[model samples]
Target: MKDIAIVAYQQSDGVSDAGAVNEVELIMPVLDRTFEQARLDSAQDVDFVCSGSCDYLQGAAFAFVAGVDALGAVPPIKESHVEMDAAWALYESILKIRMGHADSALIYGFGKSSPGELPIVLSQQLDPYYLAPQWVDSISLAAMQARLMLDQGLITERDMAEVVSRSRRNARSNPHAQLAGDVSPEDVLAQETYLSPLRKADCCPVSDGASAVVIATVEKAKEWGLPYAIISGIDHRIETHNLGMRDLTDSVSTRTAAEHAGMHDGKVDVAELYAPFSHQEIILTRALGLGEETSINPSGGVLAGNLMMASGLSRIGEVFNRIVSGEAQRGVAHTTSGPCLQHNLVTVLEKA
Candidate 1:
């Protein structure tokens, strides 16, 4: 198979409230910056265009149609949309390249989560019969997961607090991060728990933003005369929907996806994991078997600023940035969906 590489990537500032700015407005600037980075004029420059988003955030059907407006589909460009996060859209674009459907594709994901109650909006994705009706928000489910981890001796409160502390410290250098500062675990522990066994700092802040990435065959990347990072392997796995039946303390699906993604084939110098909760970060690190050699969440991960549908793709973008900037030789990026990290997508990126 011909190697597909990311040639350019760009993202908007993650804000708590992007008041009145529609999805199209949020995506346009990101697309423009990505085009400028890849030296393309517009969406027409790519063989295909795809996107990821959730209409539930807008409380309207076909809300994603507005995203195409950012493409200026003057001549009717070939495009597609995924109801999931943009990371899945990236997966779809890779399939397009692999199947000879197109040589290059542009992928983007955006979400304006501030307008709605994000936790409640997310609850709708739960099992409709039992969970959704009870209005079990995402945070409560995560809190339950944390409780399981604590009860099973898999992790401690300090361990979770340290994750948040480190995330804030690392995010201090990320201009796009919504929450960044020199915070310590002690500082995090001092705060009152939002949910039993979980402090507000232990959870990711809801953020509104868009992210874009341009990918092409390595041949095309060289032809375009730009720096690139090869996507060596990518795979995703989903757990059964019965949340009660799964092991909340461990992310078995993440491990399965990592194995299929060939993460063991090379040393992971950096790992960009989409862990919305602090304890989940620890769970993912253990599942992937990463150690001191790996730099986890240098971009602060989701605990700094979670972009909902777009954070997954941004994880891949963060790895791409690390490779191109000579920060590392290889890395792994993980994206998740569903309650308690039930689904996972893992990608291995390497220097070109």
Candidate 2:
């Protein structure tokens, strides 16, 4: 693969509800900031443009076409869209660059999941005959996964609460985070359970937001004279759909994806994992073999605020932020989709 570098990343504030903020409005400011940072005038300046969003969130088909309004329609631009998280959209853009189709690309993802029952809406994405028909919400599926972990002595309730506590505390430094404060494990355990074996604190709060990233070849970055981070390696993997067949306690898919992404090539100074649920963070951390040497979710991750389609991209963006700011020499970012982390993507970033 051709060496590529991320030039810029920007995101909107994570809020529980965006109220009357239309999709275009929510995305415009983020695009402007990203463009400014990348020294580009508009999406037209990039060789290709791709977005990540879900039509289901708006209850209409081809809803992402409206996002074009934010991108400017008069000038023709090469563009595409993906139904999955924007992190996957970044994956697509990376392939486009490596294939020599383009030297630079703009990628973005947006979501407004507060308008409907997010859990129920996501349930439709599950196996139609076996799971979707039953209308099992996302929380319930995760709760079952948590139960399996608990039954096997993999983690304790206190362990889960500790994850939440760290997330909340870590989010304090994130200006865009929705849930950030000092809360201890005892405080988390005191809260009543929203679902069996899973407290509300253990779940990510629904959020409406958008995030954008710009990438180019290393030569392009040097020509632009902007500090950047190199994308060392990336890979994605998925497990069997049948929940009963897989080991819920371990993230086999994450481990496989990490190995393929060259995560063990060197020391990982920081990691931004897209773990919507607290326990899943522990699962990913252990799966990646991260220790005290690595900082996990220093920006509080999705648990601070969950933007359905965009959080995955935000994870990668977070790592880029750390690297450019000199907080980390190399970092790993992880993203997930489906119930109980059924599908996973891992990305490795390094200082240039």
Candidate 3:
């Protein structure tokens, strides 16, 4: 495989609703920032372009076509799209470079989840024959998983509360985070449960936002005179769709992907995990075998702001930011999809 480096990353401020902001409006500013960071003129500067988004959120077929307007594709650039998060789009860009199809690529993801009942809207993505018919919301599915962990003695309510407390506190420093403050675990425990075993704080807020990343081969990075982070390894795995057949307390797919991504090859200084629920953070930590020496979610993870299709890419971008800032020499970024953490992607990055 050819060496790939992330040279630039940018994201919009995560908000509860980008009211009156169409998807293209939400995307253009982030893309402009990304291009500026990379010192590129526009999408035409890269050999290929790819995006990640969900048309379901837009409530129309071929809705993602409008996102291309942000790229100014009048001259026609090689481009692609994924129905999944933008992290997967990054994965695709890596393949393009490895195949010598492109030397550099631009990637972005965007979503406006406020107009619809976000959770209910996501329910339609579940198993159409079973869970979809019953309209099992995302929060409810996560609550059931949390309950299983609690009943199995794998985690405690206080343990879950502590995760939320830390996320909010850490998010205070991240300008892009939507939720941030200095709340204690005790304060969280005092709040009423929104879904039986899970408090409202335990769940990630529905957010409207966009994120963009610029990546290229090592040779291209040197030519551009840009500081970059090396993508040491990246891989993803998914479990069976049937919820009843899997173990909720453990992240089997995460562990497998971590192994494949070579996460255990060296010390991990930090981790940016896309855990939508607080308890799921604990699950991913255990699965990745991260110890006290490793810092988790310095950007507050998705608990601070869940930007649907973009948070996954943000995880990778956060790790890149840390490495470039001299805060961490090596780190991992984890992203997940599907209900109850059914699908997972793990990426390792090192300073270049």
* All models, RMSD in angstroms: 0.6, 0.8, 0.7
The list of candidate 2 runs beyond 4 A from truth reads: none
Q: Which residue pairs in candidate 1 collide? A: none
Over the stretch 1-352, how does candidate 3's per-residue lDDT look in tens digits? 7789999999999999899978889999999999999999999999999999998886777767989988999799999999999999999999989999999999999988888898898899898897899999999999999999999999999999999999999999999999999999999999999998999999999999999999999999999999899999999999998889999889999999999999999999999999999999999999999999899999999999988899999999999999999999999999999999999999999988
Clashing pairs in 2: none
Task: Provide the TM-score for each candidate, comma-separated.
Answer: 0.99, 0.99, 0.99
Tens-digit lDDT track for model 2 on 195-313?
A: 98999999999999999999999999999999999999999999998888998889999999999999999999999999988899999999999999999999999999988899999
Tens digits of per-residue lDDT, candidate 1, 79-164, equal 99999999999999999999999999999999999888999999999888988999999999999999999999989999999999
Judge candidate 1 at residue 269 and give its lDDT.
Answer: 100
Worst 10-residue lDDT window, candidate 1: 55-64
For every model shown, the clashing-pair count is: 0, 0, 0
